[model samples]
Target: MTKGKIKVSSDNIFPIIKKFLYSDHEIFLRELVSNAIDASKKLQSLETMGKFKGEIGDLTIVVELDKDAKTLTIKDRGVGMDEQEVERYINDIALSGAEEFVSKYKDKADTANLIGHFGLGFYSSFMVADNVEIVTKSHKKSAKAVKWTCDGSPNYTLVDNDRKERGTDIILHISDESKEFLEEFRIRELLVKYCKFLPVKIQFGTNEETVKDKDGNPVKDKDDKEKKITTPNIINNTSPAWKKQPSKLKDEDYKSFYRELYPMNFEEPLFQIHLNVDFPFNLTGILYFPKLKNKIEVQKDKIQLYANQVFVTDSVEGIVPEFLTLLHGVLDSPDIPLNISRSYLQSDARVKQISGHIT
Candidate 1:
């Protein structure tokens, strides 16, 4: 049994995170899931670079809610860490494994979809959980599996584990006050809001799907109704319309994506503008012009902002022009500067340029 204190300059870090790090406690899910997606992307990058000889199978991230145990687990089949790596990354505060991996393979791999920036994402789990356990097995051949446990304090425990998978499983023991996260509806809502357009697949639970026959037709029961089968409920569209080439997409494709973005809004858009710029700062998104009503304020704040496909905020006042706020759809850019919480944007010249480009 290896036990040690987490390296931090301040003893009040955990408390600060729980109380003030994020304005909304629900952001804990986004941060943790984003870390999981980063792990998966890291593995894909390694495979692209020929560094990982093993098969990269099933990169879907699964978010399981164990309400009986008051626990939520985010599992990913990605680049898991060894014992020493866990000690350095988990024990040491503010050292981002994703950032380090991207830096090391920036020239050798496709790391455009990696979403982790701040190293404090893992600590956000403490905001909603009383205790957290990370069971991980490295992707390296013959690597040993290990488990690290922390109880929302500076102290932590690391021990050998029997985990057979080559990935990470983050188990969060939901706190008494934050038991709402254990609810299926709340988790599904959060997954839709924040991770609906993430680059990797995210499964929250299972949904009923109509079983199909060999001829690609729905299988019917004796009563003539379609026979249903349970399948993993993947929340996000891994490849959203905006992520694809505009030339390859038609008018209907854009409209379909708009419906995906706003299922409640039934009105079709007047027109769509596909924005893809790469020179000053990387940006790709689609802006929709909806029919304006008497009140423009109601239409304002419909433009959603995303950083590397992770939804940041819908209030894109500074990033987009005031008039453009009436527009609907998404704006994703890895170059956009964001605060530690990723809830707000930091002022930058690129931001001003993006606003002007939108105008």
Candidate 2:
């Protein structure tokens, strides 16, 4: 049943990866969505710094639903892909795409440069869908538009697609088994749960409302100028507490931001630590000590890690000390290698260095 090259390995790699690496399946969505956020963040940074003289439009990620087609699409108005990028980014499933993206834009963590670091993030769609397609056009007008198709296997097809914009639209054809992903409410809840403070705007659907006329009366007429409003729930916060300098941010600002992060969470953060260091490696974050009642179960992805203000991972053990897992808040460190493993960190000097730095 097994095909090709007899895939040599001492340990049962497949089972090991399935069980160990994928400790959390829902993490796939987190990874994929965060990658989109990263992409959007990069574009925003480029536009802000005047490096790329382009219209700085609404930086948002779109999640479209096609019930009939059984597909879910997460589109971003950020850096798109050209032919060469498509081939280099999608076709060859490299493990360090995220690393490359980060290295290229260390300061920008400013661009989605970190998202592609671990080619593994995009593949998260497979955890919820059967097939995934990436339709993109580079920010450069001269760049060629490209499309990539994959069906949950190593084999993938790269072709040219018709695209008019300089962004990416990733469509996931939902598998028969993963229909829960199609639920709008479920998707929204997930977005709010994991991507609340992500550094990009995220749009889900549209909404209709009555607008007041000059007479201050509700106008529901079909010809009314306030027709169909693009109902977009802002999914991310571009400038979060962790991104800015500690001196610039006030105590009230931190408390306000914390409430924004956790509304239902009643108890205030026991204490807050503002982390910002650029030397040995770029890192900036704010760790919050949310009240710990009775030996918390060691929440999986508590400390959200971001590169260049873009969400990279919630699993921050690599950069965050293990003891700090009990805390909650954002940890924006551009150093923690993409999907860095605990075992690898045990031997990695950077991890040790970072651990020593954390208070």
Global lDDT scores for all candidate models: 0.90, 0.69
lDDT tens digits by residue: candidate 2, 1-359: 87777654523433343335644555556666776766666666667666678775876788788888998888887778788877776665445545676576667535433444556566556777788889998887588888888776666788888888888888989888779888888787777766666666777786655567799777566675554444555666757777778889988899888887667777788779988888797677787888777867778576776555554456666666677788888766556655432112233777677778885
Question: What digit string (tens of lDDT, one per residue) describes model 1 on residues 208-286?
Answer: 9988988999999999999998999999898999889999999999999999988899999999999999978899999
Compare the candidates by TM-score and give the number of the best one. 1
Can you tell me which runs of candidate 1 are displaced by over 4 Å?
1-10, 212-226, 294-298
Where is model 2 more than 4 Å wrong at Cα? 1-21, 41-56, 95-98, 101-113, 207-230, 269-271, 288-328, 337-348
Residue-pair clashes per candidate, as listed? Answer: 0, 11
Model 2 Cα shift for residue 189 (angstroms): 2.8
Kindly state the number of residue pairs that clash in model 2.
11
Candidate 1, clashing residue pairs?
none
Error of 2 at 159 (Å): 3.7
| Candidate 1 residue 186 C-alpha distance from true site, Å | 0.3
